[model samples]
Target: MPFRPPPGRAAPDPRLDPYRERAGALFDQGEQIGVVYLRIDTFWRQTGGHLWWRRWSEPSEQVQGYIEFNGGGFDDFYQDAGTMVAEIGDWGHGRFPYRGEALQVRWLDDEESRQVRVSTFGLDDLQA
Candidate 1:
């Protein structure tokens, strides 16, 4: 049997699920505000792992856009306290943009937001 996509969008691949690739595409070379989930977990394992993150102490209200990751600093995938930006876009029709790569080794900084851009990052579609 052939798998069908939801409503108006195509289906995502099961073998390779790219996470944050889509969000990067929305960003332009200008000052723009967006929202991204300060994830509590990334690169988790079945038995044991090291990418465990902690939530923020001072909770903030969830608005249309603008999610901060002020969890001090993290070198690994544990993004509990650190902030991540969500590019303002329509996350609908079973299709959401995200980064496929781990988004590491930043070199150049985003001019507008002053956020560092991942030198070798890729994107993918998120299907729910």
Candidate 2:
């Protein structure tokens, strides 16, 4: 299932106008966009008798083009996040315009640090 923000957590920050504007312009151009937010947390896990760990790193300065939207499946966003992280070697942050609504990419630290969370919120739904 696609991730959903906790109740009362869906509002976009007012300071994200630049991202919103960028995504809005793409929506105006008749393009479909999907938000991709990547988070790398510091943690360790044991799987198949092997230990794996991930260390947090600073977000990259480079921003890639909008991820193409194909039905907006949960796996699609997860794959996009993985690809972006592979390219930048860090967390990914950016806005994506979807179906005429501007959705910002944001992150949450999960308890196990095992799942990637991707969500969307409209630009018009920003708080004052």
Candidate 3:
């Protein structure tokens, strides 16, 4: 008889839910294109975790690749010195602390009427 392998455990979802009960921005867009950044930050803050981002540059801001925001490292995912919005803004035009073009926060919802995503991007992602 052949030996059988044990079943694998289910992995937890990393994306945050930003629908219905939890939906709001913590900071204003200010004078720059801070809408997307601020929104992502707010989501992580409320959810108590981090989300993946596709870093983009200004002028011709476009998706380059995935940014590694390791969720478990920073005490406060959005407030660390290296990744803070204030510090990012200081870098001047087109310079962001993140690696990719833009930060993408993804989530899922079983509600038939609701969509499973916070941002336009990362809808197809399977992990953080």
Candidate 4:
């Protein structure tokens, strides 16, 4: 039989279901911010297994947010996060903006240990 998408969007692959579950858990662990959840869900649907993340409760940088690992050695998900942030227009830190925070992503198994910050760059930069 031919495949049909859901009411609003295309249907995601069944094989990628686990990734969605993990992504949901990670988002919840990271505090269940709505915009973040939507973006993360989009990322999961598009790339399948591009992310593996969990919440961390540390005093320093990894507080009240998620620590994501991209074993693929690329920042596609990070770029997606930035794009979503810009689209959502939730850049300012406050209640109006979704979560008022950006997610911290780390390239796992790579030589460098530095974390890449994803934030709203600006809508003007998007090509029309």
Note the Cα lDDT for every prediction shown.
Answer: 0.25, 0.30, 0.26, 0.25
Question: Which candidate achieves the best TM-score against the true structure?
Answer: 2
Q: Candidate 3: lDDT over CA atoms?
A: 0.26
Q: For candidate 4, lDDT tens digit of each residue in 1-128?
A: 11221223324434333222121112234453222111223222222222343322211110012333333221122333323334223222222222354443211221111112223212121112
Per-residue CA lDDT of candidate 2, range 22-115, in tens?
Answer: 3211122345333343322112212222233333232312222334344664322222222343333212333443444545444333321112
> Across residues 1-128, which tens digit of lDDT does each residue of candidate 3 receive?
11222223223112222222121111222232222212221111122222442322112111112222233221112332223435334333333344433332322233321221234223332234
User: By lDDT, highest first, what's the ranking?
Assistant: 2, 3, 1, 4
Model 1 root mean square deviation, Cα atoms? 15.6
Model 3 has a clash total of 7
Q: Provide the clashing-pair count of each candidate structure.
A: 13, 0, 7, 0
Question: How high is each candidate's TM-score?
Answer: 0.18, 0.24, 0.18, 0.19
Worst 10 residues of 3 by lDDT: 56-65
Native-vs-model 4 lDDT?
A: 0.25
Best by lDDT: 2
Error of 3 at 98 (Å): 3.0
Error of 3 at 84 (Å): 3.7
RMSD to the true structure for each prediction, in A, is 15.6, 13.7, 16.6, 17.5
After the best TM-score superposition of candidate 2, give how far the Cα of residue 66 lies from its true spot, in angstroms.
13
